[model samples]
Target chain A: MSPRQFDQRHPHPRPDDDSAPPPAGSGAQARDTEVDSLLEEIDDVLETNAESFVRGFVQKGGQ
Target chain B: MGVVTVRRVMGIETEYGLLGVGNPAANPMVMSAQLITAYANEGMPGSARARWDYQDEDPLRDARGFRLDRAEADPSLLTDDPQRPAPEGDLHRVTLRRRPGPQPEPATVANVILPNGARYYVDHAHPEYSSPEVTTPRDAVLWDRAGEQVLLRSSRLLAQIAGMPEIALYKNNTDGKGASYGTHENYLVERAVPFEDIVAALTPFLVTRPVICGAGRVGRGQRSEAGGYQLSQRADFIEAEVGLETTLRRPIINTRDEPHAESSRYRRLHVIVGDANQLEVSTYLKVGTTALLLWLLERRGLPMELAALRLADPVRAAQEVSHDLTLTRRLDLEDGRRMTALEIQRTYCEVLTEAVQHAAGGEAAAPDPAAEQTADVLARWADVLTRLGDDPASCAREVEWVAKLRVLEAMRRRDGLGWDAPRLAALDLQWSDLRPERSIYSRLVAADAVERLVSEDEVAAAVLHPPQDTRAYFRGEAVRRYPGAVAAASWDAIIFDIDGAPALQRVPMTDPLRGTRAHVGELLDAHPDPGTLLATLTARPPGPQT
Candidate 1:
């Protein structure tokens, strides 16, 4: 095999436009807000169950 | 979605724990070399007579398309002289960086390439084994575990030779002191993708990945941070976001540009954030998911929704997340929002699940092996995170940290011991003991309390052979059949000393997937001798130009 065979590191060269990742900038900023909002809800649940959370930490793992 | 087209090369390099057996004052460097010698005498693969070619090793090369000044590279390497007198105390106290007389001849530096296509050698006081490249995550698991078996067998062999079983090996990163070794993973990525894109998309995923795969540690901190039990052992040691150094100022995204394959065609993603896992599932997912994420990053990058899930401060986040036993500690995301590591990981999981569904279609179809493995990893990753979300204790049997914690926590409850109890620390260290008779992980496996993926037979076979689908085949076969005449081997090629030949013949394995068993098995069967094999390879036009 030639070096050219391994040289193609750009992953897949052809990506269907429709399946490509979302556009950056405004689109990214907007998506970030939604993800952050979703995260806020989960953080609230974590806070409510704070006692169980602390217990889980030490009892679960480190070694 | 286009027929699941992905198969990235994966490999691991680990520094095994070395102990001074029988003699407490025994020098570790001397003991380590003895272990290698014992294994070599036992006829283990990659004998000292067989060498490792360092023609292409450039640790100063960075993934960001540039090379660091050679002087800036860490000089803490395996430059020690075995014949030299040991320092008065603490052999390591003598800074290896000091110019110690004239540099030892490069030929004197010891290296062995095992028949399994792995490299076993001393890396400054530590015995490191770098596994051969494999195509699948499962293969990665098999090969990494194979390294453990090699070390374990060597440990036993040393015991028999020295007449004492005092030398026990542990697959741990730290000595519970201020020092840290590495359980480093490497993945081949498309070099066309900008380095910035990889760092941006992978930093948070890598930081939080330990939640699932972390080998739980006993005491907290390394060098700087204070003590506390946490999810990962190596987390506290990391100090940078991007850099070429590994020993000092460790980076989350290592910049070591040693691709091991063709340089321009491949940029190895040297991952150092992960823990050395005990559970099979933990290691499988640790490698499997990372390969999937790398595939996605190379192809399309993370979706906008997932891309913005970055940590505001990665170094601080990695430290807090490790000690956050609660696994719910709030981390500042780049988007000015506070979230737990679990939630951030869950975000990536959710996006990946969608990608899997889209690629697999309505009925979970993986057109290729990579897609199939990626699909399996996503399912397991999602389940693990969900369990970690509700009750981490529920997933104790599957995740490495949780399984170890289950065993440790039980002892705590039964014996009325605190987390800092002497017994607890002892138990923690025993979990990583390489001896099956002493390893907590081994006990767990025997009792069927934890998941087991790779079997003992496969691991034993892997010890004596190399992967059939990569250049490792040629490397391993040549060494296995001709241990003496095989002059030296490297990831990219092997140099064979053909008897009566004009010059030492070199075979370039530029392509990681080529020169595999399917490609070279016939040639190997046809020629039992190195001279004839070299002649065949040279006469053939199918392989890379020598």
Candidate 2:
């Protein structure tokens, strides 16, 4: 019923190490490789004419 | 009835972005109608393309206790009337002539109530698929994904035709131009709750919900005029805090109060602020968390602290929260306190968690399936909020905006391009392409880049059948078994015209919880014919109902 009761009954679980920087070791390197490969896949399928495709995709307003 | 959980009658309506490939000038009205016709004729051959019954619809009736004058109302708000093209127009006649098979009448093809109990029709210039009513968030995601399958199959069917232009469907909100469509969420709330209570309690929650469920966008403005990434696609288009208009002066909390059920007991909360999400967890938590809050509101009224957390300017707060990519932007509350979007969301989650525990008498174990689902939603909500506070990149698998931002950032890094790059906007549009081959989201799912809650089999089954727990089962079964006898159907009634009946037999399903498979399964089987079914239903003595 009140914020005081909420704090006592269920303590908020704000992550303790909130300001820890993002990992910059092998994990970051591995993620980079993954993104590179995903971008490669996207390149194969992305529309060749980006400007026209993006420009031509007009739609009538809807609810 | 004992304790309110997250389980309630809910549905999702998605207005898919349609485009004619290689033909920029194609009429969307005709193309949208053709897409529906192609699906009903070819995708679902034997099923009846029932006309949408507009007898119960009243779109101009506002939930804030007044109805707008019909003349002053926007033309798009006139949904009760049939939207059809000219009878002998060139588009209609040419489309009819090109088809090689026995085609449905152009008027009838505009709307088809599927065997899955969903409505596939053209609203405005977009092809919309309204999922059948379901009780849980999981089923909501299932039927919503079933709609994606419906679009995919319909597009495939149209592709096989020789001369028909290949129409591509995007499960997104905007065309990146000035126009923005919608993906609306509907929740059934008790009529006793005041409209002011809903606005006061739910505004901050909706303003901050983008942190959890936003389908990310590549541009900052409605017309993509500004070059920056935002958390939500529909956020910039929202210009009002509350209104009855949908197409113009879009609102955060829509006041359209046309409850398709018993009006005295319920009001369907027509939510229009959400983006069309492709991620399952986003859709799941989007519906789940909101339902839990409504349950709290219905059972115990708005908690005092929640009312005090109202934003100073909700309309401005909505856009600020969307544009803040850091997820740390502080919003001003009416009490002169500042809270980040994550903080406000966590407050709601914590309160609901305590309420659920109290409902179960402090027992850790769930008492029922519904409670168990609520527990799951709370746990996911807590985990996502914690991760968002600590490191947003960790939620790439669960949160849609994070997942999409990861992809866009990677593309930006690889090409050495800014957010204004045409390729980035193109990729944003392609992220929601319904085709698996071209969709970036699909590729993420395939590569285990994103998390999934429902299986493909579950979504596929939902496409062919309705959930067994709601009245949709009765509606879906009637349409599937006796397609010929069903003249029209709506959310609350089904009109049956038998071969030798005296007149059209109307079956009123005013209650959303009634007409389940358990209530009418044996009856449906015993009376295979519509005449016998109607006779037995009418002959039964009326009893006291829930």
Candidate 3:
């Protein structure tokens, strides 16, 4: 086994690409919006019937 | 349209420690059960009061669209309440009555619920999360996140719960001395993949898993010299064995042995890696990157060229991986190629990123734009780790956590303690003789034997004895003390608490007869009393064997 190294430290540089796709700003932002919209709809349902949702969802996989 | 690749939901379960303040006689398990029931009855959406009292909550829903409860009481950990009103002045306080409330029906309490609607609970003393069988790759990732949310929520809730000691949920295997505890992760693989093939491909990366996924650290050197740094992220504690035989001794990556009804079929890979990372980033990368590697294997992108990548001492390897960055040492691959820990990790991430991109696009397909970006982030993370090897002064939270761990480990060593040291087997040996039916003498002899052995090992290890050898010696001592537990060999653990005592510590095997009797009763009630547990402790019995 390699011995452990504990003292080495370096400052991390910022990413060079501002236009990086998917996981970066634009793609993640778009995904976040979609998730928010979906969550809102679910929340609306929850406001009226939290118990039914819990029962139905919890029953998906047997306890 | 071309066949769309999908991800499935997966999750993890965490158990909490329970306490009863002021009352020294409080039973931790009963308290945990009560706390769990209380949380469960608070309903899927906790009332404002419930949320204030309990700290954990998750917005994600499980497959049934039910919110899962990520973290709950282990129903095993025992502790005394420090603040219990003592009519008489003594350390052990009186037992308290169960609080009045609507208890969760037996069925609901049997398994805990996560905000995601997933259920998790304790099987034996350990908290277990059996991931919901996933249907798509994306869901698998989401499930892991959901599971983590539960853990985070549970951690907070446990902190808020009254009369409980601070609970630490280790995500790694035991040091093999007392109880080889650890965290486990599962992934569904194509059934056609043989276990041997999976092991062959996975071992190399597993050796280097710490690089991209290792939470950064700063700590004293593993070598006993006055002052050197330890670089590997995984080498903070002493633990051996990459895998443990489950309670059933089933292969770590168990074979379902059943054919799937659907045209698309796969087997689940259950991996037990002793990694308990404090950082969410570390947890995310640990699960995410490993899953990607599994995907890489499924796509035939893994290279088995490094067949000789065996570690002479995996226990050492496990410890070396957890050290903070001041230590520098080279590991020799099977081919005798010496590589720095960082170099190995960088190469692994680079290889995996390329493989993921290729597989995502299909045969010679254009790289998915999303994968390309993720690959870059992973590469940078690895690079940062490599450059920052073991610098204690470094300020990254991940690095500091490791540093603090190293400090704790140092304290253990100075105080003659071994994490996951070999005394565990001896402890099991004594506990083995402690069936509810066994004579108190047998139980006392077993528990005392373990406590004595662990104490000796701790002393020896404090004098700079090697951890692996020390643990091995403890295992040998356990066999000598209680030959029956070893022969019958039930690795299951029974947890109980004395009526009084605030330390929240596991009972020493060397305890007096009365404590051992209580422990035995607790064991019998919680789990089936093992018939062979008594004789299992002796190393070599001279008399007639059971």
For each candidate, what's the DockQ? Answer: 0.02, 0.28, 0.02
Query: How do the residues B298-341 of candidate 2 rate in per-residue lDDT, one tens digit apiece?
Result: 98889987898899999999999999999888999989999999
Tens digits of per-residue lDDT, candidate 1, B1-546, equal 344433678888888776654343555566667666666667574443567766556566678877665455456621323233212221111111211243343422356788898988877667778899988887888898999988888777777764544576778777665677888898998887778878888898888888999998878776323444778879888899988777778889888777766666689999987877777778888888888777777767758977788789999899888888879899998789998889988888887777756765666463666666776777788888876876676565568887767656655655577666655565566678788766766666654556566677888899988998888887888888887677777787677766666566656676787778888888789887777776666566544332
lDDT of 1 at B124: 67
Computed on C-alpha atoms, the DockQ of candidate 2 is 0.28
iRMS of candidate 2, Å: 9.1
In the range B222-321, model 3's lDDT, one tens digit per residue, is 2222223233323433333333233322222322221111113544454544244433344445655566666556667446443445545444554555
Least well predicted 10-residue stretch by lDDT in candidate 2 chain A: A1-10
Docking quality level of the chain pair in candidate 1 = incorrect
User: TM-score of chain B only, all predictions?
Assistant: 0.90, 0.94, 0.49
Residue B512 in candidate 3, Cα distance off native in Å: 51
Give the whole-model CA lDDT for all candidates, comma-separated.
Answer: 0.70, 0.83, 0.34
Query: What are the RMSD figures for all models against the true structure?
Result: 13.0, 7.7, 24.1
Residue B543 accuracy (lDDT) in model 3 = 10
Per-residue C-alpha lDDT of model 1 across residues A1-63, encoded as one tens digit per residue: 111121232222211112444343443344334333333332232223323322222110111
Docking class of 2: acceptable
How far is B105's C-alpha from truth in model 1 (Å)? Answer: 15
TM-scores for every candidate against the unseen true structure: 0.82, 0.91, 0.46
Stretches off by above 4 angstroms in model 1 are A1-63, B45-48, B77-109, B162-165, B223-227, B361-368, B542-546
